[model samples]
Target: MTLTLSHIKKTFNGFTALDDVTLTAPQNQTTVILGPSGSGKSTLLRCANLLEKPDSGTLTIDEESIGFPARLSAGQIRKIRALSSMVFQSFNLFPNLSVIDNITLGPVRVNGQSKQEAQDAAKSLLDKVGLADKADAYPLQLSGGQQQRVAIARALAMNPRYLLFDEPTSALDPELEHEVTKVMAALSAEDASLVVVTHNLRFARKTADKIVFLEHGNIRFDGPADAFFDSDDPRIRQFLSIYDD
Candidate 1:
């Protein structure tokens, strides 16, 4: 399994955010976490990378259990985070840095890769994301969609084993949203092992091998995309119905 979460539970200030959520995602398969707002989709992604600590449960990547970093050293948590790269809804890029610098920054700083080596890798990633020409442009100069694509390129620069997306297209206008989605679709097609928490149901349907529904901080449904499309479950049908109307 590429990822396994067992009895995962998280709470904040006496409120339960996630309760006993369990899931297993296969390697090279796109798994989209679907849910309404505040359904713990983003929380799940955050917990997976140790960005948000789970109150209880085990998270395993590639069958190896992850030790909760709150109990471990800071360096240990960074290592785990490095193994998985997250793309957020907001394009989190340095306004002062050029696109190329944004992409190469982390690998150089955290991985301690030489500047020349990081640049070579960043160039290849930029080409993959169709942003090679925008290398010198700062984040503020690019459109929202372009900045998000640069974020993807930056994540890829780390050469992570898994990719996590948290509402990656939520902040874009319709036209710009399409641009980002097209790039994401292409990437998912090339490598299916992507975990995305998104409200884009169409992208979930088209790109995901498995669709897991979360409601009230719990896994309401987990099955193949076809089942989700068919939506035999009452809750799944009701949840999906919102989009139709």
Candidate 2:
């Protein structure tokens, strides 16, 4: 089982964001996408989740394949989206709703789980993410880390086949970021199928099973995490130099 993007290309107006990018994220492994800013890392992740449809490409999740630049019905779109859950850099929680309500909304509404069932699942996810006691609190009441944890829990409540995180801790300080990254590390250890886009080298080194590095809308390297870090390629070496302490 895998999520595969074949010969994917995307452009905005006159600028190319991704050019003939082909990648496959296998099940039960953490695939980390790394690149400098505006190197098409986020765009690639968005395309995989169908948030930004590729101008030309085919996205295949397991056995089902959807080719872009073709009309897709609402149900078809929903089916594609249901295969994965995404947590954005910003915690996109509903401020008006309580934490528990926010987590349960998707399962209860989209997945058609009963309210009680959704709540039970949400609570279990909350406990797993160390937010069990804050279920009744509002998003505004939580810190950046807490809110992001809630977002992670919200994503998990869907029981998606893949979890996509786009710079999940980019908005927090180091201490707060650790709180969220700890949860992610635990998930990676559990062998959850994860695709993460981040500049956090430490987390990538520790958690990534595979690494795909992009540069100027092209893939610079795709290999095991150890090989990526130990690469002799000048582009990758320069990129890694920036994060070297």
Candidate 3:
């Protein structure tokens, strides 16, 4: 059971965003993607989620595999996408909806869960993320951290096999970032399959089972987290130096 991207490439306006990137995120492990700005970390994650159609590659999620740049039906896309859920750096919640509603919408609308079932699960997820009391509040009423937590809960409601995060805490201050990271830590402890793109070395060191380092749209290193942090490669060392206090 894994999410595999094989020889994936993506470009935008004649600029390459990913170059022959092949990565396999195994089930029940955290794979942290680290790179400098424009390293294609977010682009790779987005490709895995099928938000951007790859110029070329094959995406396989467990038993289902689809080659990109091929004409795909809406049902085909949805079937493949249902295997994973993503939380972006910005909390993309519906402002008009209450917190509980935001979390339940996906499960009810897309996943076809009954409203009661979705709401029941949403309440449990909200409590798990430490936002139970904010259920009736609107997204605009919450702090950034709280909004992000709600985003996490919303992602979880889908019951996806893989949870993809694209710099999930980059918009928050340190204190608010900690609030979201705590929930992520708990999920990691439970051995949820996660692929996270971030510059947060501390969280990566503590939570990542594997680390994939990218540069200039190509993978530079892919290995165990410990090996990545302890690497002697000049590029890896140079990147790590920035996070060194």
Candidate 4:
């Protein structure tokens, strides 16, 4: 399976955020987008799922174009979005909803599954994410890692072909981050396609199948994980130096 982005460009007012950005994410692998702040990594992820629409680009999944040659209708965009689900940096769980509700709402509301069906799916997903016992708990009741896992489950409830993570562990402490990173590593073992935007070098080194480095909204490096870290490229070395601290 593949998700391809061709010549994507996004602009805000007069500022160009993503300039001719293009890349492909393959099935059952992690493609980590790395860059410093304002480097458009997040913008790239947002464009892939249409959270922020690209001014110009072709988005294709599994070799089929999502919308091409013509602008998409709102319904078409939603249909395309369902093909891949996104998990945010901050756990965007509904505070008023219980864990099971947070996980089941998408399948029930978006996928038209029965409540029981949704609950069953949520149950399986919770087990997968190691949050089965917290099904009845509220968001405030869990740690950041637990909430992020719930977020992952909610994304899975839609049965997406690809999962997008935006700085998945940026908000958590190191210990909590490790917990979530293990879950991410587990997902990769299951051949779950993932696209992540992150700066956590240790996690990226361990989890990424490929690394795509961006600077000033353009991809500067795209290669295997080890090569990216071992390269003598000044930009890559300079950016990585901060982690030495």
Candidate 5:
């Protein structure tokens, strides 16, 4: 299984955010998108799940192309979304809901899963994210990391073929960041296909099977994580300086 985006181009008021961006993410591995701010990393990740429609592109899951620009029927759009679930950096939990409730809402509402069915699956995901005890806790009661893990669990509850992360650890403190990355590391070991947009170079190096670098709304490098680090590209070298490494 794979997720492929080809010839993707997006513009708002004619300001291109992604220009001819093409990426292929194969199954059972992690692909990281790296770039400085305004380099279009988030936009690219958003397009993968149709959260942001590409002005022109062919997004395919497995082998079927789902055109972003085409006026897709509701069913087609739902089918497209079902194939990938997005995890945001902010956690995006409902403040009024308990952790379990937040995780179960999507499956129960969007997937038409009964409450019991959703809860059953959510319990397993809770354990997987090390949040089995936080199920009944409100988002306000949890740390940023715990809340983010709940978000990850919420995405996993859908049992999607791919999980797309938009800088999942960006909002957490370094200690808290470890909590989220640990969960992601466990996910990477499974059959899950992950496409992450992140500025955390250390985490990217640790979890990424493949690294893709973007610059000025264009992709500059695509290769193994180690190779990307060893690249002669000055732009990539400059990124290393941004962090303490």
Candidate 6:
């Protein structure tokens, strides 16, 4: 397993977000977390990255447990975080900074790489996402799709082992959304380990190697993408019906 969530549980003010959720995300494959609103899909993804701390249970990266002030040193925790990159629903690019700056910030600040080295890396990543020409353009100057592509480039600049995408295309227009999806598809093609939280069933079916349907904080089904849509389980069937053809 590239990532494992064992008995992971989290709650906020007595409202449970994740209920003893257990998952084994395979390496070199896209594993999707799919569910309706309030299904704890985003929460689960946040927990894996320690963005939201779970009340109980363990999160392991390649079999090594990690968290704040427990099972890992501060430096080790930072390193672990660097090993995984996350792209949010909203493009979290630095509005004031140019595209290249947004991509170079992490390597220069977190990893202590020289500005020249970071710039070179960021440039390559921007090119990979088809934004090399927009290097000097500010985030506000770009289109929604362009900003999201830059966000993807920023995450890749970190050289992470795995990538987590949380509704990466939800904020774009249909045409722009298609562009972002193509970038995501390209990432999955190049790197097998990609974890995503999305409501796009077409994306789930086309890109996911395994799909885990989440409901009320519990996993209702964990199987191949086709099996999930074709599941005999009534809950799975009913839930999918909302998005089914």
Ten residues in a row with the worst lDDT in model 3? Answer: 236-245
lDDT comparing candidate 5 with the true structure: 0.89
User: Relative to the unseen true structure, what is the C-alpha lDDT of residue 193 in candidate 4, on a scale of 0 to 100?
Assistant: 96
Would you list the clashing residue pairs of candidate 4?
none
For each candidate, how many residue pairs have backbone atoms clashing (under 3 Å)? 4, 0, 0, 0, 0, 2
In candidate 5, which residue pairs get closer than 3 Å at backbone N, Cα or C atoms, i.e. clash? none
Better by lDDT, candidate 6 or 2? 2
The per-model lDDT (C-alpha) reads: 0.86, 0.94, 0.94, 0.89, 0.89, 0.86
Regions of model 4 farther than 4 Å from truth:
63-70
Q: For candidate 4, lDDT tens digit of each residue in 1-245?
A: 79888888888898988899888998889999999999899999988888887888888886458543466788877777898999999989999999999998888888899999999989999999988899999999999999999999999899999999999999999999988888988998788999999888887888899999998989999889889989999988999998523
List model 5 lDDT by residue over 1-245, tens digit each. 78999999999797989999999888889999998889899999898888888999899996557776888778877887888999998888999999999999989989999999999999999999998998899999999999999999999999889999999998888999999999998899775799999888888878899999888889999889999988888877878778524
For each candidate in turn, the TM-score is 0.95, 0.99, 0.98, 0.95, 0.95, 0.94
Report model 6's TM-score to 2 decimal places.
0.94
lDDT of 1 by residue, 1-245 (tens): 57887789999898888999998877888899998998999999998888898888888886347644348678767777777899998988999999999988999999999999999999888888888899999999899999999999998888777889999999898899888888889988997468999888888878888999899999988989898889777877888889532
| Predicted structure 3: lDDT | 0.94
- The sequence of per-residue lDDT tens digits that candidate 6 reaches over residues 162-236 is 898999988888899888888888888886589999888888878899998899999988888888777788888
Q: Any residue pairs clashing in model 2, and if so which? A: none
The alpha-carbon lDDT assigned to residue 191 of candidate 6 equals 63
Which pairs of residues clash in candidate 1, taking residues 3 or more apart in a chain or in different chains? 28-192, 28-193, 29-192, 29-193
Q: For model 2, where is the 10-residue window of minimal lDDT?
A: 62-71
